[model samples]
Target: MKSLIVVDCQYDFIDGTLACENAENAVNSIIKYINSNDIKVHYSKDWHSIHNGSFKDNGGVWPVHCVQGERGARLHEDFYKHVEKDVKRPKEDNVFYKGIDDEVEEYSAYNAENSQKLSLKDALEDEVIVAGIASEYCVRETVLELLEAGHMVEILKDGLGYVDSEDHLKNLQDLMERGVRII
Candidate 1:
C-alpha cells in the first residue's frame, strides 16, 4: 500500500497571509489524485501559535498566518468539498499538523500528529506519494524526510505549487538527483 500525503494546503498558504502563485490551482490536482482508491490520503498543515519566528510579528520572514483558531489557518474550502464527504476515498481521519511551536520552522509532515496522536510515519507504508502547496517549503521537506525514513518517495508534480518559482524548479531537480521519483 502507498500513502498520499498532502502538505500544508491551508488558507494562509493558499490565498491568505503567505499566499503563493498556483497554490490554489494544485488543489484540484490533489483532489483528483486522492479520489483514487489505491492509496491512503493524509493532510498536513502549519498550525502555528500566536508568536513564532516564522511570523513577522516575531523575527521571521513570513507574515503571521495559519494562526490557531483563525479562518486563515483552515484548509481550502474546495479541498473539503471535493474529498471530505466521499465514502469511497481513503478513510481520512487524521490531519497532521506541525509548527505548533513559536520558534521552529518544522516543515516536515513527520513532525506532525493527528487528533488521536498518531504519527504519519506509523501510518505510512514503504512507499509514499507527496503533493501540496509551497513546493519549495513544506512539500519539499516532507518528501526529503520520507526519504530519510527509508521510504520510496514520489512527488506529484502537477499537484505542487511553489513559493519561489526558480527555487521550485531547482528543488524539484535536486529531489530527482537524490532519487526521489517525480510522477
Candidate 2:
C-alpha cells in the first residue's frame, strides 16, 4: 500500500511569517496531485507553543510562526477545501502535530503524533510518497526518517516549497544520493 505524507503545509510556511518561495504554487500542485491520485493521505502541522524553542522569541533562529491556536498554525485554505471534498479524506486523527513541547525542536514529522498519539512512523505505510512546504527542512528531515525506518520513499518534487532555491536544490540532490526517489 502507498501513503502520501503532506508535511507542514500550514499558513506559516505558505504565506505567513515563515513563508517560503513558490509555496502557493507548491500547494496548488499538491492539491492537484491529491485530486488525481488514489493514495491515502496524511498531514503534519507545526503546532508550536509560545514557549517553543524554535521561535526566535524563545532563542531560536525562526520568527514566531505556527503558534498553537493561531491563524498561521492552520492548514492552507485551498488544501483544506480539497480535503473536505475528498471521499477518502483524512480525519483529525490523521493529522499530526509537532513542536508542541517547549524544549523540543522537531523538524521531522517522523516523531510527530496525532491527536490519538500515534506517531507518524507508526501510522504510515511501508511505501510512502511525500510532498509539502520548506523542502530544505521539514520535507528533507521527514524523508530521512522514513528511509531510516526502512520505508520506500518518493518525493513529489513539484509539490515542494523552499526557503531558498539553492538550498532546496542541494538538499534534493543529497536526498537523491541517499536513495530517495524524486518524482
Best by TM-score: 2
Model 2, residue pairs in steric clash: none
Output the TM-score of candidate 2.
0.95
Q: Can you list the residue pairs that collide in candidate 1? A: none
lDDT of 1 at 54: 88
Model 2, clash count? 0
Per-model CA lDDT versus the true structure: 0.83, 0.88
Top lDDT hit:
2
Assess the local accuracy of residue 73 in candidate 2 as a C-alpha lDDT between 0 and 100: 93
Instruction: Put down candidate 1 lDDT per residue, 1-183, tens digits, no spaces.
Output: 788888888888888878887887898888887776477778887888888888777888888888987998887777667785454232346678788877678888876888778888887889899999889988888988899989999999988988888999999999999999999
Per-candidate TM-scores read 0.93, 0.95
Q: Could you tell me the C-alpha RMSD of candidate 1 in Å?
A: 1.9
Tens-digit per-residue lDDT, 16-69, candidate 2: 999999899988888888888878889999998888887788899899999999
